[model samples]
Target: MPYAATTGRSIAAVTLIAAAVLPLTGCHHGGGSRPGAPTRPSAAPRPPAPGDRTACTPEMLRFHARGVRHPAHRMLLTVTNYSDRPCDFAAQPYPLLRLGPGQRAVTPAIGPSDPGTVITLAPDATAYAAVTTAADGASGRGERISQFGVALAPHTAPGQVGLDSGPPVRVNPRTARVTYWQSRREAALKW
Candidate 1:
């Protein structure tokens, strides 16, 4: 009975030592534990913010110009939406004529102050505008410029001038994807 008791105590001691040592064997501090080991939780992955959307493109542009009997020029511009979604847009006037060495281009001295106009375009829809330029009574005849320059209001940003025209310019809204078509021949403007 005495020998059996001693054997039992020895077994218990071995079991206790093993319990303590086994955990330590597998326990690595992940890195060298000199001082102040970093205990910060691993950074959680985050999703992109709402402002990370792609920009819109101008699908179509057209211009028409006409010379009137009273020394005035009239221009009509059409912009088409080629994207799957609707787009809001505005216009910026760009002079089409380059003044020659002796020639001068006349623009209205007191014209409309507003340069931007907002329009919505449904997928495949077109927006049009009419611009009139009055001549300043001067001397010789000058060459008439035909082309009118303008750009898409949104260009590719979100804001007051952003393109929110329809359903937020989504991708492939229905059957056809958004696309654009411009006039093949350039229209002339008489001076």
Candidate 2:
């Protein structure tokens, strides 16, 4: 019958159209446990790149100094990972001591430890460095350290920070020292 033939043609045309359009809509089979379950958009975070990640830039790292402790004479310099992806930092970070606002940069007499290893910082994780100064205030000793500035690398420009936000850490010109960067806060805090 002509009517039956027309219905067959219509069914064939619709099948062809669906076959062409389904793939365009990103429809795929077997995405779920079931053989034909529909797959929804994934809410998972993007996977981190395999192997070693990139070095931390100034933007990715945030500087934090938890209140200074007396007697111990050591300040924990926390570098928080603000980035979504894991990043690397050198084993030792050289500190550029600023005595006052707009004062000449004073490099610590002691440099970072040698054979620097790469430190991986996960998102929201922190790396720490121990800043040791004379238990007696480095103040009135001619060089009064007010702020600490750190760079991404030994050769990079110093990252800017506010010296007045927290208690100012004074470093004795002759005795100030900074430990190599450490993954664990406890390890870096050790004298």
Candidate 2: Cα lDDT at 90? 48
Instruction: Give lDDT tens digits, candidate 2, residues 112-150.
Output: 342266667889988877767654555444344445566
Q: How many backbone collisions does model 2 have?
A: 0
Candidate 1: segments with Cα more than 4 A from true spot: 1-56, 60-72, 90-117, 136-141, 153-191
User: Could you give me the TM-score of model 1 versus the true structure?
Assistant: 0.32
| Candidate whose TM-score is highest | 2
Instruction: Write one digit per residue (lDDT tens) for candidate 1, span 1-191.
Output: 69999999999999999987665554474443324545656699555454333223434333233333332333333555666665454232221221222322322212232233334456677644333432343222343333322333323321112221222211111111111222211221221
Superposed Cα deviation of residue 182, candidate 2 (Å): 1.6
Question: lDDT scores for all predictions?
Answer: 0.36, 0.63
Q: Give per-residue lDDT, candidate 2, residue 87.
A: 79
Worst 10-residue lDDT window, candidate 1 = 170-179
Error of 1 at 174 (Å): 45
Model 2 segments more than 4 A misplaced: 1-49, 91-117, 135-143, 163-166
